[model samples]
Target chain A: MIQQLNDSTSEAIQQLNDSTKMFNLYLKLGFEHLLDLAAYDHLLFVIALTVVYQLAEWKKLLILVTAFTIGHSITLALAVLDVIQFPATIIEWLIPITILLTAAYNLWTLSATDGDSATQKTDLNIKYFAALFFGLIHGMGFSNFLKSALMPGEEQQIVWQLLAFNLGIEMGQLVIVGMVVLINFLVLNFLKVNKQNWIKIVNTLVMVFCIWIIGGLLE
Target chain B: MIFFLQILSLWLAHDIHLTKAQVDVNTSEQSVQVSMHIFLDDLEKVIQEETGFTEKMHLGTEKEVPEGDSLLAVYLRSHFLITANEEPLSFSFVGKENSQDLLAVWCYFEFPLSDISTKKLTLTNNVLMELYNDQQNIITLVGPNKKRDYLLFQVDEATASFSY
Candidate 1:
């Protein structure tokens, strides 16, 4: 009877050990949602992009987006490898500055041009380059989030987890961009509002929001 | 004016204790002597009436001195007096060879120790010291041990006592 009792106790202990292992595995896998949530900055960036939708040529827009993707991807990989670290405060301040500059540019172009011909000639090359530069800073921000969350110990599992989180962020960004594009298309086809007026209102609102964020940072 | 007043009040009130020495478990010798000097002027009349009969009062009723470095920690907690939110204070434990005592407490505040104003620290009293742990969570105070020596003072009479 004592032997039987001992065997049952051992079995219970084994079951508990298995449960704890399963719970740890769940935590490691469940970290994808945290990465998805870090894409909050992309919301404002997409909203800012909406203002340029009517003005920017399809090819130019595609090129700008690709440049941003490449710049951020490069920095994200470098940062994760511990090749570089940027001051968190400076990066935070710069994000709002970038948005404000983009809005100012859009506002300046709209105000300076009178006719359709003049407005069509106005270029967004400088704004595209600015987006690419800011994207690097944004990538560093993402890398910081990942570093804190993963807490990379000697285990090989951390690297795998980091890769998974990065993939999740990319997937999240794609979903957001897709939704924005679909919404823009639907509004343009069905709503029949003047695109230029919409651009002005959106850019102005973005500039105001950016300024508020900057003020908060300064405080 | 308000800022200057605040600074002055803080300067007058804060109690800071500096560390004298620290010992680790592996390095401690067989026995260590700990000593704290209580100035007769800092005690209340009540405490003096209670413990004045003895020249040396030993308060370790449980016959347990904390193991190794824990003794140093207990000594620091017991010997030092601090009031909440006066000024940022720092402590350093200096190691010295003393034939009489294994542990010695020497404290100096940002302000003069004599400048400290006594306010009642009972739960019902308006003035109290709320101790917090490392996590910034409030530390719940347990019932006082009768064996430990308490420095009691009467502000109205400018008199004090030490009692066990």
Candidate 2:
């Protein structure tokens, strides 16, 4: 009876260890997905979304990113659940297109618009909505990565894995946003770069990169 | 502009480097089956580097190399290993198929076991670890009596064992 009790206790500990390891593994995978240079479309989108804002607007930035995360989370779950399916190539192509549009929007707002407070409010609302919608497309791209990594007969643990993976991605995005904000602060304050000029420069560069990606996809 | 061009050139030649494997042990059949998912381009590049195969393998394409399977088998035998009860077990390459996107291939392998009960099972999967520093190999092993184990293999750590 003593041996039996010991055995059960060891088994329980083993089970807990296995679960914790699994969670950490998925979380790392999700974080690495954003940081992976080969899969830079997601990284590009985050940068484009971020360059338009200043460090003072972190609260609004947080909400905008969360909206995007919520949007992608829904579609990511749907795609992983096998409820919706699309060609991987199409999703890959669409990712760069989203980045291109976002960059263009940034350029237009910076250069073309004389922003009164009311118009700026409406513009911010529009930006939030666009982030959410583009996030849906990005979610499909993420689903391809998760689906390829998923193991057969591991459906029971899918929920936990998905949650951990999404959390990791969110954390990774915030890190990128933080770095961009810090750079903006340093360049504007120390280097004395004009905020408007800086935003325009970054957006223009992003647009050029997006075009190159889209052009490659077309070929 | 120069920095952008350099990054563009780098991006053109690279894709995510990840491989996944599933190991299923059947107590009733006294057999173990392993399936691995690998990118075709990465496989070709690695094979070229390891085996001195200069020709384009065009793996997963209509004009695939005739000796692609044999080359792949040799590579797998050298890189991936399975051991049962502290004794190394040999596996035969069963078959392979193109993944849905055709960007990757799933290779199947089988290991016949003499004893149904295995006290310890160890796997060493270092496939593509040498080529890419960021390469990751995910293994999901299902042992006897429906016991499951999962491991992520990186360049530094490539071996894992399960004790039943």
Candidate 3:
């Protein structure tokens, strides 16, 4: 009786396996939504950029943004192709550091000069360059986000998904920049409260938060 | 740097089973014995050696474990599906023992099965076998066969379940 029961159970399991294989094949063949909600780092990058640049220079901002785009695109392609890789934990830590550094640079430039209009202009230009460099780091971080979404087996889907996600990122970034600009124009410029010191204080606080977050990530 | 080291050390200290396997058989008089082993290790070295980039240096404060257990429990619960019936199964670390360097997790289900068979279990794929369809059945088994003891069997009508 026991031997007969084992034989029947084995047969049942075999049939189940066969049916599951067929079902799985169908599941894999369909359109899989590879992209999830954008990573926190991606959101943080946009927020950090918006926070630092209160006075907007359109031309410089465009160039810096393009440089960032190119840098991340190159790295994403390289990383996905097995040409380059980093430990995920390390990358996670670097992401917040990039934000912290950008904020630090903002604070440093703002604090170094008195309330001279010319000094502010020069510092704004320095901030623009700093944004470009930081964009490069941020791009690497973005590639890491995209890499996880695009699996090895779905190589054919990589290019399209990459394009869509990058486009989405650009859209998200533009939206954030617009919001920041609008908020600054409304509160700082229109109100004309001479809140330059307040702005510096806010930036300092953001830097501290970024540092704390980085510490948490590293741990 | 210290923060990064702590993260790496925590990752290394915990066993991460990538693949596992088990088999079980029973008779009317024997008590069930479940034996399972999982393959887990820090793949950091492999990743670093292949990637040619060091992890980011973390110069931040250490984070305390929010809860009592290590971070591994949270990670596993989120990343892996460990279930009995339709409920999530809680796993406790049984410590490193028997030269295996593997963490053992124990849980019980109520059921009665004369015998159960399972195919090879793996992390990417798992084989689960449950016996008995009625509630309140009791199962008991003696020492597990060492050669194929990786399989775990439970005889609970309420909690016994299987998946492939």
Best-fitting candidate, scored by DockQ: 2
Candidate lDDT scores, in order, read 0.42, 0.84, 0.43
lDDT, model 2, position B158: 90
- Candidates' DockQ values? 0.02, 0.27, 0.06
Question: Which candidate's lDDT is highest?
Answer: 2
Local accuracy of candidate 3 as per-residue lDDT tens digits, A99-165: 7776666666666556688987787676666666666566555565444333223465455555655
Q: What is the iRMSD in Å for candidate 3? A: 12.3
Estimate the TM-score for candidate 3.
0.46
Tens digit per residue, CA lDDT, model 1, B79-119: 33333234312323332222221122222111122222322
Residue A204 local lDDT, model 1: 87
Give the per-residue lDDT digits (tens) of candidate 2, residues A65-91. Answer: 988898899989999989999666677
Q: How well is each residue in B28-139 modelled by candidate 3, as lDDT tens digits?
A: 4322223333222222232233334355312111332233123333333332233323334344432222212122222221122323333222221121211111101111
Give the per-residue Cα lDDT of candidate 2 at A83. Answer: 93
Give the candidates in order of DockQ, highest first: 2, 3, 1
| TM-scores vs. true structure, each candidate | 0.45, 0.82, 0.46
